[model samples]
Target: MSTHLLSRHSHRPRASLSLLTRGAAITPAITLERGRAHEACGPARRSFALWLAASTQGPVLWITPQWQPVTLNPDGMMDFADPARFLFVAAPRREDQLWAIEEALRSGAAPLVVADLEEPPAMTPVRRLHLAAEQGGSLGVAPLALLLTPGSGGAAGIESRWHMSPAHQGRQRIWQLDRLRARTQPPACWRLQQKAPRSGLQLCPAPQADLPSEGPHLRATQQ
Candidate 1:
């Protein structure tokens, strides 16, 4: 028999085109899984920042825009003991009030500033606050502002944003903490009660397994 010329392409197995396409489809899912895993591993940036501000034993400025004639007694003061220092400012008007608050924040006299106003602040104002905090070497605790409204308008400088809400009461006058916004971590809810026998308010623990049962009872009314 006459020998046929061997074809160069005959011997090699065909490459799997389907395998390449399948790997391409799997890449995005793998990336998403890794992202979720990272989020689960760390404490939310906002919550951690709030905790730091609350724990700081320095001067703090509290701005209450909605309620007038607000006062903080020694006991009420102790409730926010983490931010050990404070200055209470009540502003009724938006324009005038924000300006005054901004001035105080820029002063750097206080390490923390809290604004409880009716409307969420604009992005520019929030950015200013961030810059002020950075320059002053302080933290700002804006529980109300961050909660009730859209903080989208605020400046891009905010390190973290948190949404905190009041939880139910326990045996004493303990309040629960609900977190609505925590960028890097999953949302968390917990209870924090204080014992203030000397200050007149009592501390009570929630009826949860992790919480302890031995604390003074908080009176129904604020002293």
Candidate 2:
């Protein structure tokens, strides 16, 4: 093929949505490509989702199962984003939850769409979400779809997968964040903490020995 044709076929650089505060000394800003679906698992998955919501501007569309026993506490969400900024979509069934997520992504109205899922969905639905996000991006804003799964997330075809859990030591509030899977990044770990209330978050390397094993808890603290 001619050089011109090759250039036309080459992949273009993609836009990314920042997922965390950029105050970490050695760590670069962790971001997910816009118009893609990502996964967050582990004990603090809800907290991870809240962190993502805090990083973005505009309204957030959060979809969860209506029958789920526990719901997001407004007081708990205050540390991240304003609870009033979130528009909740409570789906009555599993399939409805996925459908709501798909529609929200396709609409491109909200910059972030979060699905608090008990478990991860299959590859086919994930692909559909990717397509919907791409279409939404073309129409207006490029929405980022996040799946909050319980335990060790095993969602297939996701742009990336992250696991976070509490690593508190006495009075200090800390969490261990692991980039378990990514297409372009290798596995890595970090210790995330805030110096004070309403202060910027800090990230530092976590010692291998300090990393905690996956716990059975699904609920995350408001911190």
Candidate 3:
């Protein structure tokens, strides 16, 4: 019975291996998936975006609300990326911020675009972004889009969602990358170690052995 079932299942098609991030063969491709998006939040969002920026080519378009309580310092960002490659747009209102993100994705001039938000945008705006990214917008590859929110992100209708928190130990600046939501993969976690003096992003698979007998507490991941 098992052999027969296996034979029947072997006919199904499989997705190709295409990765945009540093590691993980199981992570989904960040290309041409309409009506889906990626999200990350918490204190590690800036460093995560900056780490992503280094892996891609072309300019990065950054959008934020003018009234946003926090600011992006070019001097600090230059430590991970070239500040000159970033085009900052301050949207005076929430609607304008969504519009800016939509237009930037539709233009495809940037290889990556990061939007810093006080809270998650509505589902409609998220759908528009997914559509624009899938259409390719006259570029060879669809531009990657990331939304940064405060607290654990709860972006509606996204392809994948992640939560990052600082877990520094001694002189090392370490971070925990939690894969909150994904369509095809199970929840995962990683330890990101930032090597000093420009060694770049270093990723390590966070061991699952430390999880409790009941399993890892998931409350912190999907928030």
Best model number under lDDT: 2
lDDT of each: 0.37, 0.80, 0.67
Candidate 2, residues 80-141, lDDT tens digits: the string is 67888899888989999999999999999999999999998999999999999998899666
Instruction: Name the weakest run of 10 consecutive residues (lDDT summed) in model 2.
Output: 214-223
lDDT of 1 by residue, 1-223 (tens): 8987865665632111110112234211111110000111111222222333344446556665544433434443334343245565667677766675566656656544555455555667766654544444333332112212323222232333333223334434343343333333354544444344222212234443233221221113322
Residues 66-174 of candidate 3: C-alpha lDDT, one tens digit per residue:
8765566665666566778888898999899888888888877887888988899778888888887766444466677889987888888877777777676555556
- The prediction achieving the highest TM-score against the true structure is 2
Candidate 1's displacement at residue 59, Å, is: 2.3
Per the 3 Å backbone cut-off, how many clashing residue pairs does candidate 2 have? 0
Q: What ranking emerges by lDDT with the best candidate at the front?
A: 2, 3, 1
The number of residue pairs in model 3 that clash at the backbone is 1
* Structure candidate 1, residue pairs in collision: 54-82, 54-83, 60-85, 123-153, 123-154, 123-155
Residue 113, candidate 3: Cα error in Å is: 1.1
Off by over 4 Å in 2: 1-10, 22-25, 205-223
